[model samples]
Target: MRILMATAAVTALTLAACSPAANDQKSGEPAPPNPTQTVAAPAEKPVYRFKIGALDAIALFDGQNPVPNDNKVFGVGLTPQAVAAPLTAAGQPADPIMLEIHPLLVRNGDRTMLFDAGLGAGKGQLMQSLQTAGVDPANITDVMISHGHPDHVGGLVADGAPAFPNAAIRMSEAEWASIRANPEMADLVRVITPKVQAFRPDEEVAPGVEAQDTAGHTPGHVAYLITDGQNQLLYTGDLMHHWVLSVEHPDWTVGYDDDATAGKKARLDEITALRASGAHIYAYHFPFPGLGKIQTREGRATFISEAQPAA
Candidate 1:
């Protein structure tokens, strides 16, 4: 039995080494080369890069992951066909949905705020993106989370310690509640709580940064609204998971949504409000550094990539 277990572990390790997403980085350099296999390119280099007035916003790439074949990412009511057809029409995969995580970094004056910490060191390639943009993780003053999902929070602790030792980690108070209440995540929650500074909804988390309660994806899912004196940018957390499905069908719930109904409602409401406000939405899971705007036509929402503005 011991020999069998050891052999199985070795096989798993070997498979991991040969995975397509394997690290291609050389010694002491930034991330692996920017993947040439991108579905679409942003307006500029470093994935999604933009300037919000004086605030410099860059979407740090965290690589892409495949949504499993039978995953119920689009709620219980909708079939995969309903989700894939539109993406296919728009030049995306018809199956095996690929999701890109863009952990955004906002530099405003002296304050450096990171929207979601990238999958640190191991799971994803955010650090490379950051390095490409000339950002040092140690300089991040604030680490603001949209929620506590592994992709968003996995970078919090790498090698069993706070990844950002110098930064103050911020999270919604209610989000902490849901995470801490779960028995499976209790230890992680307990370990993280000491470093966390919980903020109430609709409060100013940082200078020119306001936290909006965009619940439903999680009990305490919050979006950050960053405004310079003139320009504004809104970072929508996981309210929407996929660009095509979430925007086109805001009614669909994500597989990870704690309350599918509430998630759908929240997604629609937030998208509608942002569209009306005419603020650029920086989505966490829409696409890399998901910088896009929401367009409503005949009562249906569509994602308009920032690089490809609507006519």
Candidate 2:
């Protein structure tokens, strides 16, 4: 049943590690660049903006972070051929899987909010992207975290101090507990501990921002459903890393999940909910600027990037 509608990796070293870039002219003008093709960049340095109901949104392009597919990171229980099949179908190389790193930024009234800080200072182009977006680190009022992974929380600190000086660092209490005990995150914990405003799952931390539990990828994994009276958008943290393997094939187990069984169930359930509500999404690792909708066509639910030209 073809329901006509337009819209939208975890690889080896993925969960352990996470840029999205183009020289940029001005996006959202004449159809977005193909997620697969490398087109001539517009003058802007990879910053994209759009509206989510009434709030303004931006996709800060950090730069490419690719993870290897040859490793047992993606198709955990399946054969290598099973993993390669989707990439082959998508005409993408099966190894050294390509993914992007871009954190989402949105405005909630007068407050400036960032979702999932990018890789740390000097590690990725997060700072440059912020500059292109005309956002000053000091003015960020809130920093909402999806999880505590390095790639997601890397930019939270720099040189043993908080990076977003004025922002309230928010994350699930479970996630804060998960990382605080990990000795490997000792340095990071020391810096962010005082600033983290741990919230209960499903709690509304801010005006119009509700944390939806989607644990399994990590103990405190979550997605944000933000609405501004007229519309809503889901900021999918690390819920699904790869579009084909994770989004299209939600049943496939991912190596990054702390609990693969629960992770798979959450992935399927989230996809179903997205399809049912038809809300727009701000994907953490779908494609660059990962804005799109989930549509089931030919029995397969896919991420349809917003304003993408005919494929």
Candidate 3:
């Protein structure tokens, strides 16, 4: 599903998209009145990095692009304004919403697994981000996908070829079937199917990694759980997108959900389970390097931004 907002309009209008003021403050950091003074020796922009026991996880920002905020993209009933209103109120661009597509790479022992390829070959910088993190695409042993959306699966093939030539591409059977059947995604499916390895729900295809069938967002939507003895972390692939929005109102369906009702149910259940388990979550669409925990407050679940602490 797609929601439209005009985030890039200011840039198109040439009204100072990124000024000294914008760049100096840094994201998740306080904005200085005149940040240009700090520009001389700027701090490195934060990169998402963490660990779950012995498993090391890194959030590689493949960069993001804006999609038109049309009514139908978000599914059937939701309007663009309805979704944009909250994000705008929260200080995010209201007209054209930017979707930050992050592809995660998890390293366990010698196994380097990349979760969701991101907007690969066509027009993203996932490779650069990976390199910045000291990871090579060829070093990725496994490429696990949560779904078949263009952004999620697009990175599988580059320039009409498999990006990770040495990696085994894995995804849900339902996702492969849906992508294959859709005329729009048929070409991508055809190209990636040769390398595509399908798996079912509740199955542990990888060592301590278990595939949990979340569904609803798309027919075969799934989440992966990584556990090391007692501690665990969950990679919720687009299961929950907007922070605060999804947590505050877990039932509010996004236009992207193929089955809104099913999405709502799965989200509620997953949030509950995640909270109870106290498992850290890596959300593909939560925010850049979307890493955080779900907290229960006021009888409702809330997404507390934990990647960077408040000053």
Candidate 4:
């Protein structure tokens, strides 16, 4: 899902729409401060470089966007206090949670592939980030999509046309089918169909990249596993959004998930498997350049972001 612009009226409307009538009594409680009002200092550079065996992987920071932090948006069955605990403990704001959008770039020899296209022109900083990374859209040989959400597919087109004209746009066959069938996504499908290369679940979309079925967030949703020799990194599309809530409370279903039950199961299973494998993960909606490893401590999974390089 795309990050929506925050406005007082819109925020109020969203909270009202998602919460039950019983929560209205809390209206007397002071409204939570809006996090978007506080602008973050601009990142000095948009590119975060790391290696996966011999392959070079780069995370391109698109932009940080704010979403309503109501319990309805995240912990549907839990209280705000429950959802806010992990955030507070992590030294993060407990209201108006900000989510970072980072599209990944993986280079293997002559192949240059983009994991996901970010929010389209005017909405995100994908193009600017690309320039900062010294990546030319024209030179990209492959455009692999993790899912069909706008944030993931928007950057695929620019000026009403495919941005990476020469590149093959890869998506799961099931996802392609869903996109074609959904009226809301018809326009997007039309623009990308020309280059769309639909593959089966678990199929290798590239030399070292395999599509792992992780449906639940959306019908036909999938994640990518990029393996370079014995090293691998899992590009989790939207399996989990918030680093804390999603990791510590895998059972809590976010409002964006099409099938909350399925999404919860997928999250639990994926985190367990990733923790066992000890593979690094790049969560799309986590912090910018969301590079981290999933670790289990006393039966709880936590996302530990890798330390940033010193300036």
Flag the better candidate by lDDT, 2 or 4: 4
Question: For residues 1-311, could you state the per-residue lDDT of candidate 2 as single tens digits?
Answer: 00001111212212111112211213443322122322113124467777888889888877566777754678887877888887776555567666667898899878899998989888878888888778999999999999988899999998889999989999998999999988999999999888889999897888889999999999999899989887889999888888667877888888889999999999989988887776788887765667777765445665656533212
What TM-score would you give candidate 2 relative to the actual structure? 0.84
lDDT (tens digit, per residue) of candidate 1 on 1-311: 11221233223333322333332224454321111122233323445567888778877777666775354765456677767676665556656776677888888888888888867677877777777888888898899999988889888876777777778889999998888888877656756777789999898889999999988889999998899988888888888777777777777657788888888899888877866765778878765556756755334465655542212
| Candidate order, lDDT descending | 4, 2, 1, 3
TM-score of 4: 0.84
For model 2 the local lDDT of residue 84 reads 86
After TM-score superposition, what is the CA distance of residue 216 in candidate 1 from its true location, in Å? 0.8
Residue 134 local lDDT, model 1 = 85
> For each candidate, what TM-score against the reference?
0.80, 0.84, 0.78, 0.84
Error of 1 at 108 (Å): 1.8
In candidate 1, which residue ranges exceed 4 Å CA deviation?
A: 1-48, 69-71, 297-299, 308-311
Q: For each candidate in turn, give its C-alpha RMSD to the true structure in angstroms.
A: 12.4, 9.0, 8.4, 10.6
Q: Model 3 — TM-score against the truth?
A: 0.78
lDDT comparing candidate 4 with the true structure: 0.77
Cα deviation of 143, candidate 4, in Å: 0.9
Show where candidate 4 strays beyond 4 Å: 1-42
Error of 3 at 262 (Å): 1.5
Worst 10-residue lDDT window for candidate 3 reads 34-43
